[model samples]
Target: MPLRRVAALLLEPMSVFEYAVAAEVFGLDRTDDGVPAFEFITAGPAPGEPVALNTGGAIVPTHRWSDVLDADLVVLPASEILEEYPGELLEVIREAHARGATVLTICSGAFTLAATGLLDGKRATTHWRYLDLLARRYPEVDVTIDVLYVDNGSLITGAGTSAGIDACLHLVRRELGAGVANAIARRMVVPPQRDGGQRQYVRTPVPECTADSLQPVLLHVLDNLHEPHSVTSLAQRAVMSERTFARRFSAETGTTPHRWLLQQRVLRARELLERSDASVEQVAADVGFSSAALLRSHFQTIVGTSPQRYRRAFSTT
Candidate 1:
């Protein structure tokens, strides 16, 4: 019932695009349908000075870092480089987080926030290209490299540059409602929703399928997830030795073929569990698992919950 106060922390060499995104969504008073308007302010390390941006532009902040203690949400725009995160910046972020403000970061800006130890032991994402580095840099942080973004309640991190828009839209939906977020998306001509599980841009597209390559075989395996197939049989169908087929499959998918196939089966089982009233045994059979026990074992291992619990949690509406 009260106005939400949002502050975007503008650091030197700020990303104008990310900053503009924060302003458009939170700073502007666009409440034509009676949605609550937020009290938005740009804040800098120092009070009331023009902050330099990477887009050859400057924006003067309305407040200093001290004013951020009262903010409900604080956005950290993407940092220009991975190493520019300073101790002062880390302290500001850490203090804001300690005060219970939702700290959100876009792309590599997560690196800066993570420097404060806020994201440690929490699931988060950053630009997918820098994912391995993020994981390596902050081994305590649980990095999910594939998702569009991760929402850890108190802290949110987005993958890549454009995924920042997705995360911001998601925040609008979470804080206001879907109607407000959809209206903003319509105005921007962007898709209203992309699941957090959606893939970011693939770094290097797989080489085009060759006559002897495993792409065709992989497709068939995916299409028939319920089928019982063996490595020997698959290699025979492709007219290659098992070792050669495994090597080529790994090159194409960045994972072993067996692991990929098992993951797909787990995915299929989850869909059935979530969408259908079938018992765990039925879903297991439908997804090529030999038994419900095997299904429950793998489902809990991969989906992080029992099949029955997953079904109950995500039953079709």
Candidate 2:
């Protein structure tokens, strides 16, 4: 399916930000800018009823719950984490998924989708605040952590407010093409893509000179990804002993030098694949992977897809 129709299911008490996120991504017409426009609708239990918002004001949906069934994609904004969601709402989600509609949850909206039992045995996540509760309540679901979003094909879950945008854009990139997603991202002034597996937050909340001082080194490494470099070499360049550099690097980047290097290499490879007419082998070499085989392994690990398939979906050329 090309994802032409989209309906957001709004429930009370409404979450203004997540609802706004859905509206901004799908409700707006972006066709003039080369982004595909969706037949966006706000659906509720009653077509013309008002749903109270958590922030005070209420939103009136334009369509009834039945309208959600016709959508190619169903968006669920954040919902109240009550003892249970409405039976009718849960049924609608199940029916929607059963009919091949992609269901997306923003923030605590995962709780509503989880109630339908569709998320059982599938990897999913909500906001970090609710991860443990979601796992405890739905014992069958494979609850993931530390990631912004999880895409289990038709059922997708976003971590928090901004993650919703990333998830929606990813779906656009997955179905329509990266060009469309890029156009939308540019219009919104956000990154076109962030791997769903990227960490939601770093353990070190405070900024430190260690991370700041390493900026030059990080930038240099990015500029010369094709060159061989290790922690020792990076340490030498930073004018720090290897042991201190290694400790600071972990504190600053939240990952070891080798892992961060691999992540950066994959990111560069993605750009090359999307923007240039380069072979996988060439992209591998350009991004510092020793061979195409090594690039494929790392690309698949970080991106959840092969380079060729990613290019097929995202390539501008």
Candidate 3:
């Protein structure tokens, strides 16, 4: 069924940012921009009770917990981790999923969903800081630490902060269409899709580079993604040794030179597939891939779907 109604479940000590992310994505009326208007509501354990926020404010939800049972989609925003979650709340979550409604969690809200036992034997993610705790506490869950979000069929779990935006937009794109998702993204001033994942944001000590920065070279590579690039050639372009260039590149981009270039090529291919009347082979060559088969392999690996499927779902032309 198409997602026309959305219900956000609020818990005490909520992280305002995550709650706001849900509102920004689904609660706001965007019909003027050619996007469908979602029937959005907020539900809590006690209707009309004020829930304290982690950032020192409180919000009162107008709907009771029962309101979520029939919603097309339910959102769980981050809250302070509690020793025990309410059994009634967990039952509602399980029932919602059993009846074919989608459930999405933002940041630490994964803990609340996990309490329902629905996440057992499924891949999920949380804030990087609490990955170990979630894993240790819920041995049944397969915790993935490096991705911004995990879309395990109907259950979607987003990592910390802005990752919620990515997960929400992905769901909108999946359920509605790329045109609606893109319009919302434009109004919000954010990308409809993002490359790589949370792994790029992991903290690491980078060795300082004495030579000039590779910012210019990086921009040039992005501008000309159709051209073949190698560590040796990029090193020469930056006027540095391959070893120095590799180190600096990793330090600056959080990925190897080859991996970074491959990601960029895939992004370029996506753009061409969505905006141009090019065949798969043409897009492959235009993005520097050796063949359409190779492009399909890399595109599926990075985008989680085949090129043809993606274009069918999202193409503008």
Candidate 4:
């Protein structure tokens, strides 16, 4: 079904950035770009009531909880991560989902969805810092910590901050099409689709290494992704023994050398697929995979989709 109407649910002590993510994606009038316009409205617990924001300001929502029942999509933006959500708001979300409206959450908004028990026994994600807390609080929900977002049919959850943009665009692509999503992304000056997951943004507790220690080797590998690489070769370039290099590599990068190389290759393949008119075989070769078959295998594992399908969905051409 086409997503013609969208309603954003605002709670007290709201996050301005998360609220803006929804407004930017659905509320803006983009009819000139041939993108369909949505009837976007902000709904709160009390209609026409001013709610305090974490940014030291307040917003007066024009609609009440009942306004969301007819919306094609219902968005829950970040608010205080409370142990309990308002029962009235939860009922609204439950009714919307039961009526086939897509439910989406950004950041701590997952807590609100979780409160409705909709995320139970479902795969979901939120900001990396809160993964453990969320899992411990709700054991029934499968909280994925690595990915930027999780899409479970009618339910979608995004990680912190900018990841909300990725989730919003993903929904646009799913309900509308790649063309409309890409047009919105181009106007926002962001990539239509980002490669890899939130794992790349996670903070590791390992001690920092000297600036020049492994920087050169990492840069060289990125520049020479098509070339064969191994621990011995990379260690030699870094002027360290293989054993020492392996240990330090893991300490500095939070992953083994082989895994890091594979991730880089997959990222390069995604770039080529999106912006270049390259066949799967050529893209595989360019990214250092032995064959198109092997590339497909790794690409599917890392990206959750085949290269051909990814290109079909996101190719700029």
Candidate 5:
């Protein structure tokens, strides 16, 4: 098999963290262990131009965006400013997709992809702070505000700065499986997988006077995420009907109460798995799962890896 080609779009005013993530994942030579390595190249909307990035550094592209007709993966690193996205940049993304390349974005880079209309009617995400702007600007897109990243086959969008590491690892895991991704994460000294979706960011503060509202209930749920609790019990404790509780919870948290709680549980479980010497069964019980089998199922499905593998790969020595 041939080595896959990956190109990162070095857009102007790029974020250093986002750019570093792509470089770390794709730019490094990892063929020492016979793993498939990507031919990583930094490209620009125009060739041979100095692209300003937020890192106080500038990148000069080896190729123009038009030169990437056959790249397997293309990345748009995050930026701080979304309102300054240029139309020419959107055109390049459109042309890239026309050739069937997988497009990935980090953090606010979703704003650039959303401008292309390719994210229309598709589930996508970005930095939690910009979800509302993305929703208002592109009402047709089903913006998932509570995901670390959304992989829609050909298009991928990440949540925040460090979440880009999770998104890239997820992509590596999908294309190369757990072992390869874990190896790469080890080389980079980052957790191969981070549990908990983007719901953690959705927990915005509520007024102190209205503390009895969903805020107090959410705090209770977070505090007891490792316990078996349900929406009905939480609603009863909060002195509101289930229907009213659900509505208010969604309005305040940007996701259903059930989904939010599950994410918190997963988050707590991952922490234990990474930090403790407990078996999967013990960790599962501590995190509210009925059994190790159930924990494994959810861990594989949502955490993107098995518990044992995550522990072995990420446990601090």
Candidate 6:
């Protein structure tokens, strides 16, 4: 279904950046660039009521909570986590989902969605800082860790301010196709595909080397993705032993060197597929995969679709 209508529920003590992420993606006028316009509205618990912002000052929402029920997409931006959200607000969100409106929560907004009982037995992720708490507090919800967002068909949750942008763009890509999603990303000057499985975890207490010390090697790998790289070679590039390098890489990237490189190669293949008329064989070579079959195997595992179908759905050329 086309996502033509959007309503963002404004909770008290709102995080300005997360709310702005929703507004900037959905509320902006982008039809001139061939991106469809969303009938975006911000609403409070009560119609025309003022909701307090954590950054200070109050925003008076012109739409009521009831208006959300009619929206095709309902946004829940990060707000202060509380033991309980207003019953009316929770019920309206519940009804909206029960009637088939797709619900997206940004960062700590997962807390609000959990209160509505929709996350039970479903995988969900919030900001990394609250990962443990979310898992412990909501035992029924299968709280996933180290992901930018979790998508379960009708419900999605994003982590942190930047991840919110990723989730919103991903939804646009899912519902409106890549051309529209890419157009909006171009307007916003952001990368359209930060895969949901990418890590958003914070620094851990595991005694480790300097954070991001492997950044140069990582950047070099990105620049030389077509080249064959191994843990030994990458470790040499970072001036560390293989064991130390592997540990540091995991600490920094939340994935092993092989898996990370595999993901990057597939992502590069996606871009090539979308923008260039490269055959799967050529794209596989371009992204450092040994053969088209290998690329297909890894691509399907990470992207949940084959290259040909992804290209057909998202290719611009």
In terms of lDDT, model 5 sits at: 0.80
- Predicted candidate 1 versus true structure: per-residue lDDT over 1-317, tens digit per residue: 12299899887888888888788778777678555788998888777688998878688998887788778899998767656576776787788778788888988888888888888899999887788889989999999865777899878998788788899888878877899888888777887786324231332232345545576787787688789988887888788999988777677677776777677788877677768888888888888889999988876655556767666656793
By lDDT, highest first, what's the ranking?
Answer: 4, 3, 6, 2, 5, 1
Instruction: Quote model 2's TM-score.
Output: 0.64
TM-score of every prediction relative to native: 0.66, 0.64, 0.66, 0.68, 0.67, 0.66
**Candidate No. with top TM-score:** 4
The residue-by-residue lDDT of candidate 4 on 37-118, one tens digit each, is 8899999878889888999998789899888898899999999999788899999999999999999999999989998999
What's the ranking of the predictions by TM-score, best on top? 4, 5, 1, 3, 6, 2
Per-residue lDDT tens digits for candidate 2, residues 1-317, read 65989999998998999999888888888989987778999999898899999999899999988878868999999968889788998988899889999999999999999999999999998877788899999999998765678899999999877889988998888999899999988988988886434331312121233566798998898899999999889999999999999999988878888998898888888889889999999999999989999999988777766788778767899
Every model's Cα RMSD, please? 7.9, 9.2, 9.0, 7.1, 6.0, 8.8
1 or 4, greater by TM-score: 4
Which is the better candidate, 2 or 4, if ranked by TM-score?
Answer: 4
Per-model CA lDDT versus the true structure: 0.78, 0.86, 0.87, 0.89, 0.80, 0.87
- Tens-place lDDT digits, model 6, residues 1-317: 56999999999999889999999999999889998878989999777678999999888898888888978999999999998789999999999999989999999999999999999999998987887889988999998765778899899998877889999998999999999999999999988885334331232232233566687788888899999999999999989999999998988878899988987888788889989998999999999999999999988777756788778767999
Which predicted model would earn the best lDDT? Answer: 4
Clashing pairs in 2: none
Candidate 3 per-residue lDDT over residues 1-317, each given as its tens digit: 67988988988998999999999999899999999989989899888999899989798998887878888999999999889998888888888888888999999999999989999999999998889989988999999876789999799999988999999999999988999999999999998997656644444332233445687787778787778889999999999999999998888777899988888888888788889989999999898998999999988776667788777756999
Worst 10 residues of 6 by lDDT: 200-209
| Over 4 Å off, model 1 | 1-3, 196-200, 207-317
- Candidate 3, residue 311: Cα displacement in angstroms equals 27
